[model samples]
Target: MFMSRLRRRMGRLAAGVLALAALEGTCTALAQQMPAMPVTVANPVSRKITESIEFTGRFQAWPQVNITSRVTGYLDKSSFVEGSLVKEGDVLFSIDPRPFQAAVDQAAAQVKITQTRIDLTKANLARAEALKKTGNVTDATYQANLQAYQEAAASIDSASAALATAKLDLNYATITAPISGRITRQLVSRGNLVVANSTSPLVSIVAVDPIYFYFDLDEASYLAYQRASKRKMDAGDAEPALKAEIGLSDEKALSHQGTLDYLAPQVDAQTGTVTARAKVANADGFLTSGLFGRIRITIGEPYEALVVPDVAVGQSSQGRYVIVVGADKIANIRPVELGPKFGSFRVIKSGLKPEDQVLINGQMRARPGGEVVPQPTKLDVPETLVPDPN
Candidate 1:
């Protein structure tokens, strides 16, 4: 009797537990089908956004000059130090001037001799003219004396010009910098003989105050920008005007500054691209010549732009689209015309409006035209952006 009672009590307790568990599962299932899945979105409006054309170019000095020696002689001394800034007319090197100095002296002596001869010839011509009047000399003799004096005067002038030429040649032996700039090291050392008008250069000078950055644009990009501009102008946007800025690859931007200084008149037939140039200041000497530089050119004005996260945009054979949330909590797959991409955002040129909210999270599993419960989530994190390495 006791064993039967214990077994019957245990069986009753187990049956009650099973019934409660089944009721709880049924209630949980009903709750899950009640609340809707959530998503996030953002607002769009008019912003001063920039569109940039990317190109890989290099930095070059504005003025580069190769210093060459104009006189033939052994270099006696280098006046200016290597890699030093020099002014125009600053003596860069001194050549052995003993030979040139002797040559100048010889030219001067020749001029003096020619002048003495001219004086003597003039005296003889005067005496001959007097004798001709007195009938003591023939006309031919007087004429010959006159010619001799004129020839002597001509010889003096020629000698003076020769002296000046010799002095100039002597000055050339001391090679001075032609431009005010930073000059490279002496190509030939002291006691090394450099010839005049030779192939070798004695040094080089480069101006570094304001540097130039050059880049290229292919024909396709050029034409595409033109076509897009025409369409924009037709659609009531202003005429096609482009601007630009500069940035280091490792930095956001050196500054929000730069200008479109140059554009090629004709396209390069070989590469089918147009060359462009930008001038940037380097006052602190931070920028070095021949360093790699980036040139960014923005082509057009900022519009009343609609933007969405790049991840939210899905592409297909039809076109790019996004699962957009419209009025009455309805979800719709809307096709959009996309403009240039700026960072992580895509500019929507058409289709979606400013009020349209785009679904970012839980978008892949969401069904179109279904009820969307927008759950605004904060995505600000400590490591959202990873900066590029230097």
Candidate 2:
């Protein structure tokens, strides 16, 4: 009887243990099936994006001038401070005016002397004519007096020319600025002898406002610009004004706006590149001459393009790519060709469609071929991010 009771108890204990094991296995399977990873996704933004090309260039001032003396004399004094701004017609240097002033005064005295002689000659000639009419003077004497009067008049004319020349030389004694600009150091200081029309400059000046930006475009870019210009002309429309943006080497954002003003007529044979120039305003005088700058030119017309937030883009051995969430809630990597960046969004030249949903936030949680619980969200885009049509 005791043996049979012990065997029954063992059988019941085994059945209970088996039931508990089955329940635990079922609970584990259900937990594994539950979704754990959460990710934020959004549809790719569709907009008309302008494509631009970048080039390295330098800033140059317009109307750069080398200031030199027009007349030879000892340097007297300068009206301008070194490296200071000067206005047009402002006297820059005053040469030794004593010599020029003396010449002018001497010429003036000669003119007065000549005028007195002319008066005396007139009086004498009148007397001679009167005597000749009364038959009191011989014909030879009258003719000789007339000849003397003509000679005196000729001398007065010569003195007048000398006076005019002297005044011009006096005016040249004071050197004035031809154009408004920032002047360099005085090459010839006070008390130093300077020669007229010398090759060496006394100072140099460069115009700050409305500066020029020069850059080189390869043959391919030159041809592209020409084609676009030609197309506009053929359509009976005015040539579109090309625009450029510039930033200094130390700057990260392009803040300067400029207009394309010049294009080389021919390409350089040696470099196979053409020179291009843009005019930029420098009202505040922030841009200095010979500054290294980065420039971007809008070379293409606006077109529909897919753009994703810069955070959405990733990189690997396969280059740049983005994660897109499909209808099955699975993350897939889409390789893309990138163009210029527009604000916080990067222009995807390819590998993305307008309706495609891309993973924006929680990128780490999302992996290729992996399931995700996608939460739809909106992207923050700037209103003025698009390029101006004009």
Which number leads on lDDT?
A: 2
Tell me each candidate's TM-score. Answer: 0.76, 0.74
Residues 1-390, candidate 2: write the lDDT tens digits.
999999999999999999999999999787657574899998887777766777889999989999888789999999998988888999999999999999999999999988898898889889999999999999998888898889889998899999998999899999899888788988887899999889999999899888999999999888777776677677776756577898899888788999877999999999999999989999878888999998878776778877779888999998999999999999999999987677678878899988888899998887688789999987776644643221
What value does the lDDT take at residue 192 in candidate 1? 89
370 in model 2: Cα distance from truth in Å?
9.5
Candidate 2 C-alpha error for residue 80, in Å: 1.9
Q: By TM-score, who's the top model here?
A: 1
Q: Please report the TM-score between candidate 1 and the true structure.
A: 0.76
